[model samples]
Structure formats: C-alpha cells, structure tokens
Target: MSTAPVFAGPDAAVPRHVAIIMDGNGRWAKRRLLPRAAGHRAGVEAVRRVTRAARALGIEALTLYAFSSENWRRPAEEIGDLMGLLRLFIRSDLAEFQRENVRLRILGDYRRFPTDVVTLIDDALARTAANTGPSLAIALNYGAQAELTRAARRLAERLPPEQIDEAAIEGELETRELPPLDLLIRTSGEHRLSNFLLWQAAYAELLFVDTLWPDFGADELSAAVADFGQRQRRFGGL
Candidate 1:
C-alpha cells in the first residue's frame, strides 16, 4: 500500500462529507487470539465514536463501508455474527439517532438480505426520515461495480439512447441524495477502493491509516481531518 504525503498548507478546511472503510476487525481479533466475532463486536464501538465525531465536526454527511458485497465469501458463522451485530445496532441505536436528529440511510442492495434485516433497515429509515442532523449512510452488501451496472441498466430501461449522460447516471446513484463525497479514509493501512463508492469517490481525497477499526477514535479522526486540510485539490488544473 502506498502512503500519501501530508503537506501542511496555510489553509486547512474540514470536508463537508467524509467516508470511511472500516477495516482490520478480523486482524485485530486474530492478533489477540480471539474469535473474529470479537473484532466485529469491538468495531461497533468505533462506529459510534466516529459517528459522534463527524457530527461534532459539523460534517454534512458520513458514509461508512460497513459491509461489502464480497463479504459474503466469509464463513457462514461470521456472517451470522455480523448480521446479529447489525440487528443489535439498529435496534438499540435507532431511538438515540432519532433523538439526536441523525438520519439513517442504507446504501446497498438490501433486497438480498434476510427479511428481518431488511425490515429493520426500512424501519430505521422511516423512523429517522425527518432527522435534520448529519446523515449517516451505511454501505451494506454494496459493491461499486454492481451499483454502476445497476444504474446503467436502470438508465437503459427508462431513457432513450440520446437522453443518457453522466448527469443522468449520477442522479440514479444511491448517493445522489447526499452531498458529494469529500474524503475517504480506510483504516488498517489498506490502500485500495475494494469496490466501495467507485463513482462517488471519483475525486475524493484518500487517506489510509494504520490504526485498526476497533482502535479508531476521535484522535485519529482529528488527525485525518487535519491531513485533509493540508492538501490542495486542483482537480484537473494547476
């Protein structure tokens, strides 16, 4: 994995939107000689911490790559454990999130999920729909390639040949309702996209950190934002 240099610029700005690829849960547990499920359970605490941090930072939106489509390749027991965690998280936190005016959005093909999990997701969305605070989007069972392909198919089905364009496809994306992705941070020192938010992250600043997801806290978050502030984004120009 390649590391990007952090330059201290005179202007430091907090991105409006932040996304994180929370990695290293399994490794963390393996290192401790515990079951991988322990790592996943610990990762849940990090999620709560990061979500609170983002809101405190005045971020407009935060998207977490909670579960990728490829995650299904894991052992059945592990997947069941993750599903249980998801259930517990939504069931326990939905009320607190609503109380804090935090909106909950799921950003993946949830139809493939079990009926009960899908119901919880739907219920969470409905309950928090009126929230006006920072929006938290969890990418569950999401793969950017699949997302793009689905978007393309949807466009082809509805629009004539001449009517299709980048704008049309962008509008059809799951992230269309949220602000543009500004910064994408991957924990556990990984430096790849891993099929998460491919289209939305076209121009996002990438930050790969060595900290495991379970250990990620406000300090790490602050550092990432600080690093983000130091860089210059020229887009396509000098």
Candidate 2:
C-alpha cells in the first residue's frame, strides 16, 4: 500500500537483489494460542504482500527462505502442513504471477519433493520462464552449506583445479544469474543467518527486525528498503 519510491532521496541507491529469512511463524501461532498451521497461513499472506511491495519498490530480484533442508527433522504432520501450504500458494498465486509478469524461480533442489509438488513447481517455472519482470526466488529445502558444497563438487568434476576459481564456483550455484545481493533481512528479532544465502550475503547490508514473519507487511518492507538506501556501502573499499 505504500506509494513511496524505495529510492526516495536523490542519492538513494536501490538494491538490485534482496533476500529475506522469514522467521517466527511458530512463535506467532503460540502467542495467539493457535495452531502453527494458522501462523504459516498468515505468513503466506505476508509473502504475497512483500512480493507485490518488492516489485512496486523497483527491486529486480527477491529471494525468500521458504524452507530449509534442516526443516525435515520436524514432525511429519508439520511437514505435511507446510507442503500443503506450498501447493495452496502455487495454485492460488500462479495466475497472479503471470498477470503481474513476475518470474518464479526455485533456488534449491526441489525435485526431491513429492511427485505432485514437483510437477506443480515445474509447471510454474516453465510458465514463467520467458517473463522479463522482477524475479521471485523461493528457497525450499535449501541450505547454504549444502549449496556451497554442491557448487564446489560440480566445479571439481568439470574443471581442473587451476580453473576452479571464485567465479567458476559461483556459476555452479543456484543464484548465478541473479544480481549481486545488496540487502539481506531477517525478521522476528533474530540475529543469525541460519544457513541462508551465506555466500551471496558476503557484502549485503544485513537488517534484523523484531516483527514476526506473519505480521510483516508492505510497510515494513518499504521501511527496510528506505533504511538500506541511507547507508553507505563501500564493499570493503572505504
């Protein structure tokens, strides 16, 4: 709902890529004495809100940490709920994504999911493959350490040690095509990366907010972008 441009000032620089670690869904449900599924449902709404806000704010790419590889340790019922939510989101939002020209991209090896889920995800990806609009990347069953290890292994398999450099390793990673990550945000007062985008965030402006994921909305996202615009980023040169 915010009409303010993300780069409000003359000198404000818009971040090319923004990554978020959406946190506190269980906490939010616990606070309300409701089921965790209720909180995750609310969090999905927040995702929709933030996705629209990011595009309106002129962000080229937005990456959301939807599910981590470690999340498989949770109870089967909770995992089932999450998978159901994923199916619901894709079914409900695929049309909106096409209408808004938003490209959907998955950052992890999502093929290992259930057959139906993988089919749905593949269909979405193929449908949006040609779109030129802002990218919305979801990290499901993702782990930065695992991603890095995979990249390294790929490089070692295809290239000689002399050719295995930073760029080569990066090219093998999932986000190789996205712009350099300029900003990373974590909500729910958390202060850790929790295995999210560790390599891409090497120089990103990290912001930790107290608002829970279910409660985060367009206004909070806009405020974070505005705050990021005010900082000086020298990328280790200043």
Candidate 3:
C-alpha cells in the first residue's frame, strides 16, 4: 500500500515477525531480456539483503515463501535452477549465519526434496539450532492449505476429539515455533496470498509493492516496516 520511505527508531513500533511473498522473478528477467535463472539469482541476493536488514531492524522471525507446493508445476529447468540456488545459498550462508547467530529453519514439506538437499537442510538446521539471533525460515514446497490439512491429520491421529481445539491446531501448525506473524509483504504488485501463510496471517497488516523480487532490497523492506509502524492494528478491537 504505502511506498513512502519512513524510518523509525528502535523504540518505535516494529513488527516482531515478518513474512514475504517473493514474486515476479520471471517477470524481472523477462523485462531485461534475460533468462529466468538470472532473475532467480538476483532474487537470492534480495533474500540475503532482507535477512540482514530484518536482523538489524530487530525482527525476531522472517519467513520467506521460497518455493510453494504449486511451484512444481513450473518448467522442470526453472525448478532445477531454483533448487540449485537453494543448495548454493545454504552451503554459502551456513557459516555466515552461524557467525551472525542467525538461526535457520525450514517451514515446508522438506521431505519431498532430494536426499542431498534434505541432508544439507538438516545440516543447516543442526548448525543453527541453538543460535540466539533472528530466525530465517524458508518455505520450500509449502502451502498453507496443505499445512493445515497435514496438521489436522496429525491432530486426529494423535489427539482425542475433545482436545482438537484452536490451541491444539495452532500447536500443530509449522509456524507455531516462530513468533506470531505481524507484517506480511508481497512484491511485484500482487495483492493475493497465492497459498502462502493463510492461518498465520489472521491479524497481520498486508502491504503490496510493485518492485519485483530481484529489485527489492533493504530500503524497500524498511519502507514496508515504516508503513506498518504508521498503521494501527486493532486486532478486532477499536
């Protein structure tokens, strides 16, 4: 919504949890007459920039919608490029994340990933599991509806009917371990969630920006945070 560049001090209103729908990589590449892989690569750089900015901004958790379950429908080569980027990012950033105390976690059905990727993901998690810094959760093969269904199944298999309440379901959700979501942003001017964190965004303030994912940087992130600071969150109350 608001694209104004606003900055707030540490004492100002800041969201503890933030999520982003990194969109328009293909479009970004197409605009420049480049291969889609180039845009995906640039998007990875954007991810790095935003992650560091979020840490500096005192955000406790940052969830990035990297690969949705529906993303599998895209061309096989594009998927491979994305997976390659994921591997490179983890291998390249693991030590840096440990040094910065940035804990890493996966927010999706990682079981579907290849054995090598799953191993790397596990390694990254193991390395950063005890860090005491802002957490970065990458959503791979994730969809909120699928997550809800999986949680429901888990609850049904493990709990009695009487115990299946909101609290129980919330506990089963993957995002239960992270801070409650406060701000959600979508890039590329898209206004819809596209199967992102549906349940977790119950009271989150939404902001849509026209910048493509490859071009979004820390400044854009700060602008969104500033916009969030300017708004009042009633959470169903006046």
RMSD of each: 4.3, 4.4, 4.7
Q: Compose the digit string of candidate 2's lDDT tens values, residues 147-221.
A: 999988878888889988777877888998888788999999989999999988887789999999999988999
Better of 1 and 3 by lDDT: 3
What range of 10 consecutive residues in model 2 has the weakest lDDT sum? 1-10
Q: Name the runs in model 1 displaced over 4 angstroms.
A: 1-9
Candidate 2, pairs of clashing residues: none
Clash tally, candidates in order: 0, 0, 0
Give candidate 2's total backbone clashes: 0
The alpha-carbon deviation from the true structure for residue 185 of candidate 2, after best TM-score superposition, in angstroms, is 0.3
CA lDDT scores, all candidates in order: 0.89, 0.90, 0.90
CA error at residue 86 for candidate 2, angstroms: 0.4
Estimate the TM-score for candidate 3.
0.93
* TM per candidate: 0.94, 0.95, 0.93
Question: Model 1, 234: alpha-carbon shift in Å?
Answer: 0.9
Residue by residue across 152-211, what tens digits does model 1's lDDT show?
999999899899987898888998888878899999988999999898887789999999
lDDT tens digits by residue: candidate 3, 2-65? 1222333344578888999999999999999999999999999999999999998899999999
